[model samples]
Target: MWYLRRFLLRQPRSHALCPTSPSSSHAPSSSLPSSPLQCRTLSSTGGAGFYNFPPSAHYDLIVIGSGPAAQKCAIDSVKRGRRVAMIDKNSQMGGVCVHTGTIPSKTFREAVLHLTGYRHQGFYGKSTFTSSRRSSMNEILQRVQKVEDVEAEVTRHQMRRNGVHLVTGTARFLENGANDAHVKLAVLLTDPEQERKGIYKHREASLPKTLLTAEKVMIACGTRPVRQEETVFDGKRVFDSDQLLWGGIDRVPRSFIVVGAGVIGIEYASMINVLPGTNVTIIDPRPNLLGFADREVVDALMYSMRHYGARFVLGEKVGYPALASTSMEQGRRASCHMWGDFEAIPEHSMAAEQGGEVKSVLQQGGFLGRDTERLFPYGIYTIPEISMIGKTEEQLTAEKVPYEVGIANYKELAKGQMLGGMDGFLKLIFSTEDFRILGVHAIGEGATEIVHIGQVVMAAGGSVHYFVDAVFNFPTLAEAYNVAAHNGLKNMGINV
Candidate 1:
């Protein structure tokens, strides 16, 4: 193990994969330069001849996903002077965060807001300033594709800038040879040319494969949607989160039945409900939405969503939809389409969550182990966003902790009125004795951005008094902190 580690450290730090020599037909052309034997190999100089290697590249770290966690792992590892390589199954650079989950969905939401004129309903009146015209699916998706392309390119540039070798392929772990200290992986490489041209046409059996060895392996493979066995997903009539954006429904459906009232379902419902002539119904077995978030915040969100024409069916279960059009035919092979790179949908797709966890491990200089006690914030981007950090009232009650609530509505602020965020509000939960902020929950426009103020204070072990004493900008949503702080202090019998 020591011998192999030494050999890896001794190898040159060139990212160039094996250069295709005129004589060697097996080697493929890569952005990387050539090695001495025209094929890079890992061999131990001072050993009992225990391991003689094939033409395999070596790295100090290899990340399996290109999502946030994988990207952070690769970038952090390189900064620590370790040779890093990242392998993603997607033809594009960024993983689910950029392509399917975060960026695309959020971008779609923005496009919906702008195209539908949903953002100006308060100032212009709903009847008078309604959405002008129904935007074509291609028209709305065009912005999503543009944003995705820019983000993907940014990720690619970041990787190259940090010297993280980026490989576009599906990677599977190979059995560790005689040594357990080193890890081996068989990366099924995608065609570089096809990827460049925004096309992903080949099947797994046809793609080229490469063997890579690394000292440390980080599996940041994101998650895919959990499909119900009873449901037949036709992508058009019925679909999951991924299918919704990627070739599920070409045009926005006049009606949408969203099954789970979780974050993803609620977000989708909110976005789709705003579309002209669209009806969105969200159903869940749980009686309440966002069971983990603050009750008051959840109530506010329900009000806003309901006002916007979203229906909720809670504490009930429904059977799967009847078999829809012929098993949702696979999308056409990738080309220069309006959907851009999002057109090449994989048979199996993944979502996000592990990125932040992996990033925490790296930040604390800690190994991947049990999660630690930390202040984690949750954000749900419904039409009006919901974000919270620390303990909820329900959590505090469950733990039998004594606390008081401080509340501020967005309507009280000029900024909120100006932006038409009448339903938005911020809530603060603090200790009864010392007034230390225990939790913060917000629901409304910029709620995700607003909660960060509370997160920073709570992280620094600050309390509600900080917000009360601080002078925030006069016409900003941030001023709600000041209002809420005063309200909370009043509850605690502290007059200011």
Candidate 2:
């Protein structure tokens, strides 16, 4: 990683990938220079491996998928003056993060919080809002769309201004052309949805596929909620996280069963459970949730969520939807459209023999999957968000690393009290001997933002004393670090 960063810095922008366009597909370019390979291996060099697409169509770096990972890589490459082209199946750019997943879910949470007076309940009560007994699904969706629109536009503009050729279509790897020196891939330029609906912009829509080769291709197509092949997606009763936004959810369901206890599942459970008339029961195969966070923090979050009427059925594995019902149609007829992990909700006390088709849906994805080895942060937006980094106490203990824990509750901080975030808290774990920061965990407002303070210090080899001596503005959540430092040092028998 360090070597790659240094190399990128040394490479001149003139040697960047040449952004391709509609015309480039029709007539490949012949402008590639045969400069010294330097360190440009098949993986790093615009893809001198097996793909055998037209040389003129070759880009310096081809980033597939417009999600965060792809976006960052593309931007970095283009800033170096590389010809970069980014492609996605969605008509609107930004992939799932902006279009259907993160942006929509978080915005939905905010909308639910504001519309139902969830945050304002401390002072004005739930009745502080209008006389509506239940929140309309349309109202929640409006906020999500508005946010997604702005974010997607920003992403597209960011790529365009940086000279990234934006291709709206689906991308697929062709052959492992071992004999070829370039990496070749295929793209369907027509919108996927339009093709599905048999709606064509013109007679040429039916044949929108383009085969282009690149020096290097980055597969950033973020994973979607993987519903089983047999599972039916009526869009109303059954849906994935992406579909959950479009017609993912109709209204705040009276009750929904979330199959996975990963970040997304818990987040959706937390947000929807707070609605006027909604209930959520989250099921996970793991006994403990958020295995990466501090035990105390996860415990607190679970307790709060339970108090809010969200049920957690941990250590329970979901049966296959096929085994639960004789046929897919029968499963859908149960009122709850079956998909993903839920073979049956028998574990949930709220489950009944019949509901025809459950108004609720299943959460079909997680940060970690046994099938893949990708690592990413898990941020669950449950009112007060939860974020963590580095090793947890459990992981360290299992590995026999000595560690200590220090906690600062939001209730004990003036800032938390000021903003009615008494429910929030920060947990800092540092080595016992030197008090060097190990991991920082927080569950409360701006927790996602707070973890970075500890991360920066830890990366710099700073210890607990760094936080204690450092002065933060009074009445700010960042000051929680000060509190954590005081508690940690005090435990170590040091006087303030």
- Each prediction's RMSD to truth: 11.8, 14.3
Candidate 1 local lDDT, 214-262, one digit each (tens): 7776665544454545656666665656666665467777766766666
Query: Which candidate achieves the best TM-score against the true structure?
Result: 1
TM-score of 1: 0.79
lDDT of 2 by residue, 1-496 (tens): 0000000001111111223333443433455433211121233243232122223355777776676656666776665556777776555777656765567888988888888776666566666673566888789889898999888899899878887777655555555435668776656555444645635342233434556667777654543444456555555555445555774455666766666665666666677777766676776777888675678778888888777788888897656453322111111111111211122221111121111012111111112223222122335577668877667888889989888777898889888877765488888888987878888888888888888888778777899889989999988999999998899778878888
lDDT of each: 0.65, 0.61
Best by lDDT: 1
Candidate 2 TM-score over all chains jointly: 0.74
Error of 2 at 480 (Å): 1.4
TM of each candidate vs. truth: 0.79, 0.74
Compute the lDDT for candidate 2: 0.61
**66: Cα error in model 1, Å:** 0.5
